[model samples]
Target: MSGLETEKELAEEFVLAAFEKDDRRTIRRMLTSDALVYTPNVPGPGLDVDEFESQILDAFHGAFPDLSIAVESLVSEGATVVCRFTMTGTHEGVFRGIEPSGETVLVTGVVELRLTGSGIADVWQTTDSLALLEQIAAYDHENVRGERGS
Candidate 1:
């Protein structure tokens, strides 16, 4: 296979290991020790591998115990692969400071992964947080309208 094809395959494996299998060890092995992750929901410059595994992966699993990711597509060029995926789960635990509503949520997201010979080096990810919140009834539309009128 070509290099791009190899990279795409790696990206697929990464996604399967991380989200489908929920294998933290495989994820850690796939990432460089100092891998940097960038996400809108996270504050600061970026997150290292450890932080990404804990704050994002672990916390998300805690919030949505039965969460599953369905990969819609993957595109690769050079050493970078972009994956589009859909996440579905029931909100059973607190997430982003919002209490659980036991509502099902479906959110779409994209993640770009930059790979090195050793492992994945950098990641940039974004998800539809507003849609997730809406699905969970976290936003009060009436209150927002009243505040707007005020």
Candidate 2:
């Protein structure tokens, strides 16, 4: 296989090994020193390798202990690889201050990875976050009422 194809294959392997298997070693090996991970859910500065592992990776692992990610498609061109995947998991642990809802959520997302040498240099990701929140009944909040008493 050509170099680009090899890189794409490596990236695919990295995603599966990291997310599905929750293998921290694989993740560390696959990310570059200056890697940047961008996610729509988290605004402001981009996530570095440590932040991605702790916030995104480990958080998901904690929330959805039995999470599974299925790759729908993987396309590569030059130094970039785009991955489309479907993630399904049960809400079993506290996530982002929300208690366990015991809800099973299925969300789809696409990740664009830029490879440097044999490691991923940067990642841009977007997912169906609204679906996840709805599945967990995140919007089922009590309405506030105002009282007038003088």
The digit string of per-residue lDDT tens for model 1 on 14-99 reads 88777667788888899998899899988988899788878888767888889888889999987889999998999999887888
Best by lDDT: 1
lDDT of each model, Cα atoms only?
0.86, 0.83
Residue-level lDDT of model 2, residues 38-108, one tens digit each, is: 99888878899888888888878898899899999889898899989998999999877779999999989
Residue pairs with colliding backbones in model 2 are none
Give the local distance difference test score of model 2.
0.83
lDDT measured at residue 18 in model 1 versus the true structure, 0 to 100: 71
Cα miss at 63, model 2 (Å)? Answer: 0.4
TM-score of each prediction: 0.89, 0.86
